[model samples]
Target: MPLSERKVVARRVTLELANLVIKYGRPIVVNLGVGIPAMVGEVVAEEEVEDLITITVESGTWGGRPLYGPDFGVSLGAFAVISVPDQFTMYEGGVIDAASLGFLQIDAQGNVNSFYAKDRIPGPGGFPAIASGAPEIYYAGLFTAGKGAKYEIGNGRLKIVSDGEIVKFVKKVDKVGCSSKVMLEQGKRVLYITERAVFRLTPEGPELLEVAPGVDLEKDVLAKMEFSPIMRREPEQMDERIFGHRRMNIKKELLKAIRA
Candidate 1:
């Protein structure tokens, strides 16, 4: 894919994560942490969702607006910026809800491995800090099945699907970003979403919340997953509106922004 197209995918994926956050808003302020979560901060600022839901980034961008074009705010100001320490304080204080994090791997218990990858590809960032700060943590990534998404079905059973190149959405993570054992002990809420399905951790194991539309064959979803989830009726549609929000309102400046 072209670099330009890749950037568009990144923006769209980030917006999907943010849109989920906006749809599931709480009555209180929700502090969005770094990376993809920060892009959510941009989405909220743009009012593509709702202003009642506040956004704060650990990188000191709070309630910021988006800068148009492929630059991703490279040549423009970061709107509604805040201080680094303040963001951390809010997070560490448990002020954040539903942190949608990107990870190299995520296990059934919701432990994430983002700090490092196989042979140590990606270095650790603030994963531990954010996990500590946020009670309700969600891990997300694109779906794939190769040699990576493997588990012996020791606990129960694993009906394998297409093997993934990277072992994300695995039965057991090679490293510990967070721990399922710890989450079980703490009774914390854990969620996992890929392009294919959504799973949540329970005492029994991972429960299938929903599956991605069109890929509804049990083996197709199961074959790709490391652990077996209780069968669900069907997954939900991501919605066409998610792709086209420009028609929501048409301001002259909005049109000029797109053109310019």
Candidate 2:
């Protein structure tokens, strides 16, 4: 069966993150948050780099594929399953090398609202602890929200059939789930990854880093955002392979990059 467009976008974001892990060229522990961030475990597992990239979930599981939905708090083949408090202890103590978290909204200042909205109240769930502790954080999710968004993917490209009505990047988030100020003071590396664009949180503010292929810079990206991002240079195109259906063979790429 073919993967849905949403799932494909999730995989693409996950693979991009996997590439970042590979670039470290050494063993590291990484925490996966809920939603699209949970897909990282599946991507790492498929890449066969579990030994190098240790997967951790807030539910106290480590070194396995992180489950989603009803099974969100467990891993399929975890090497360890400690108490939830112990897992949080590691996070609050800065034991993890990195973390990937989902966001409900992101502001011009890079503040993230992962939980809470005008209509919902999921509350902040391990986001505060993990975001505060991890030296590096990647915020992952779709480019837009709300109902009726549509897209097409083929031939290594993405075509926006109809965009979501809700704009995720805003002037100010409804609530600040993760503070950009604190992260900057702590000197953490931060990135926002969406289906069509990537932004890096810098001293100057959010900088536009990369854009997916076939997406219009003006109509599809810049025009949709609430505020302008720093364009230090022409943004690079996101890797073309992510748009296709075939396996990325990320293990081979990781090994090659490590060897070089």
Candidate 3:
């Protein structure tokens, strides 16, 4: 397949994520969210992450590599698989350690709105349960949409860090997919990972932990985010080691297997 600029960039984002999850050392059940992160599981699985982390598909299968082609396949290097029927059950109830999911919008309350795209809203399928109930959640998406990169963080609820800026990170969520108030109380970790920067929702609100390597704070990442997070020391590049050899880049593998 010929590579386009968009595809190349998207793959970079996926690779970065492959690095992020591995840092945690394959948790018991890494909920492979749709899109890039699913491929990340395959990448990790081909390597040793599978031995450490049991990769579960939204499907029920527990220990088989991905079979890609038939289900609108994408290739990945993973070990073990399951049917989607079983996967959603675990998803709806709660048996996930970390979820690398995407979102269309995120507000100060830490709520997410990924289902509401223009033509249709898929309604929140398994989102509320996963976002709210998951022990660890990582919200992943692109940094800037065509929205021109600016907005206002209204002064309704939480006493926050900043207001009026670009979007996705906010002073309060417009609707509650996940609540910062609840997260802090429960002590579960919620991360905001984007192509532009990485932030964490803490008791203090969104804190800027790291920017992708070679990206600058004021010049690149910070200015793009709607609000300024409390930047800790310069953020480091998520380690590539996370996507060890065998399992790394499993997308193609799964897709190929399913096709075969």
Candidate 4:
């Protein structure tokens, strides 16, 4: 059976986030949040760059492939499994080099709403500590919401069969689970990654950075957002390899990038 569109998008997002490790050019530790962010650890394992990139989970497991869904809090080959409090201590101490988290809503001011909406209240979990402590953060999630949103993937491109009825990027989020003001005060680097586009949090607002292939800038992106994002210049196209079915050979790319 072919992979679902959601799974494909998750892989695309994972590849892009994994590639970010190369930019650091040295060994680093990263906390992978639940949902789409958990997929990054699997990609790191597949690419065999475990030695260069350490994966940590909120459940206190470190240096292993993070599992998702029912196995969400555990790892496959974790080198260490400390107490949950200890894990949080590491996060709060700014020991984590980077973090990738999922978001429910993000506003023009770059505030993230992760775990509360109307009657839904999953609480913030470990998001606050990780978001405020990590020097760099990559917020990953789908571009839109609602069951109406549909997509097709082929030929190294994305096709929006039908856009989601609900827009995630809003003029103001329902709640602020991660505050841009706090992140800025700590000098944290923040980027929001989705299936169709990437944005960087700036003093002005979220700045458009990259758009996926086959996506319409006006129809798919700008039209779907609740507010206009800062576009300093023409946004570059996302890495084409992200849409392809073949392996991206991320390990080779990371090593090459480090050598450069």
Candidate 5:
């Protein structure tokens, strides 16, 4: 299938987030959420850090490279597959360090609506258990979704192909898949990652943390969202490595780290 501009940009976001998770978080057990978040494990596998971080999915597979799309449950190089009950036990016991998942809607309260909308009712799947159990949760998706949604990456920059009609960040969600207030009260950290920007959940709401290169903060990002994010005085620009056609050398570094 031909990749969409949004998917291209989202892949870059996933690569960037995966690198951060490897460096700063260094999670020993991580669950790469479905959809855009699933790419995190693919990038990790490319980086060759499978041994360092146990890549797992909600379907009970562990230490394997996750497959995307319709073949999601299948994996390569998996260490083992446990029963569903055992997997949830691990998740509920706070064994997962981080979970990178997809989102359909996020509200000012940081509540997520990944499942169950007016047109769609796929249900939360394992989102509730994963969201509640993980110490840090990252929601990954495009800033907006609908007709005309598109983008491009070139010359170490990002350009919009066509803006999507729907805004994802809102004042309220149609249904709460994971309650932001409840998660925060448990002292868990939450972050929302988009192709254009990254937002961290604060007491007030989602706070802008970083903006992508060649992106206008006001016109490209803030103006596109339904709700206003708590902006940093000078938000950090997204890593240049995430843009352009260059291949990242994270695998080399991962091998080196392992050897040491």
Candidate 6:
């Protein structure tokens, strides 16, 4: 795959993730974790749902329109900025509607291991507080990491360069940064959205919900996970709109839903 086409797959994956989040609708408030999770805010801005979504950061920025890249820590048109402690109060009090956060490793039990992986960065920051409180949690990231995993776009679907040496979906994570067991017991809705598939947490385990086009459910997804997920009888192919090169009219749809 050419470098240019690889870029296309990368962009499409990120946008697909953002679109996935929008389906949950605009919550009264939400927090977006760093990395690809933060990129979702960029898509929200593009979809013109900033007012509807109200993106928050761990740095005490509430109701701030998220700014990606170098301007990430600051919001473009912020409504308010409070102290760190006050923000924690909000998270701990279960005020956030949803929290979209990054993932390193996840297990059958839904435990996440984003903080203690070797050969990668270590730190949970405010992930625990955000995940524990948010009624809905979207674990956002690629399906594979390390090794030589790469992506390309062709035939309206994404192609993998090489299956990465490391598989992110494991039987047990290196450490439990956020306890999926606790969240599941509390009856929170937890989802793992990757570039190729989506899974929902269930009493049994992670349940397969959707898979991207051109991906093999058995070869690409099921084969890579350390534990077998509960396969939906008829798992849906991710929507075609998720692969488009242009921004979707999610703003219009969201506004219409609000009015209705």
Model 2 segments more than 4 A misplaced: 1-5, 12-23, 256-260
Better of 1 and 4 by TM-score: 4
Q: Note the Cα lDDT for every prediction shown.
A: 0.51, 0.83, 0.52, 0.83, 0.77, 0.74
Residue pairs clashing in model 4 are: none
Candidate 1 per-residue C-alpha lDDT over 1-260 given as tens digits, one digit per residue, 9 for 90 to 100: 11221122233444444444444542224544333433444444443433344455446554435333333322124446656677677777887654656567766555666666556566556666767776666665555633655322111112333445754666777778677777677666777655445677777667776543344445656765676665455555433222332322212323343344
Off by over 4 Å in 5: 1-27, 251-260
lDDT of 2 by residue, 7-105 (tens): 555566566556666777666788989987887677677657777678899989988788865778788989999999999999999998888899989
Task: Give each model's clash number.
Answer: 13, 0, 41, 0, 0, 0
TM per candidate: 0.65, 0.93, 0.64, 0.92, 0.89, 0.86
Model 4: what TM-score? 0.92
Pitting candidate 2 against candidate 6, the one with the higher TM-score is 2
User: Residues 5-70, candidate 4, lDDT per residue (tens digit)?
Assistant: 544545655564455666677777889899878877766666688887888999999897888767
Per-residue error at 8 for model 3, in Å? 10
* lDDT per residue as tens, model 5, 1-260: 13444444445545544555556545467887778777766656655666666778988899888888888877787889998889989999998877788899999888899997687657788889888898888889888888987687766677776788988998899888988889889998888888888889988988999888888888998888778888767889877666655555566655554455
lDDT of 3 by residue, 47-135 (tens): 43454445555555554444332542232444445566566767766776666666767764455666665566557665666665567
Which candidate, 4 or 5, has the higher lDDT? 4
Residue range 152-238, candidate 6, lDDT tens digits? 654557666667898999999999998877888888888888878888998788899888887888889988999999875878877
Which model, 1 or 6, shows the larger lDDT?
6
lDDT of 2 at 34: 90
Least well predicted 10-residue stretch by lDDT in candidate 1: 1-10
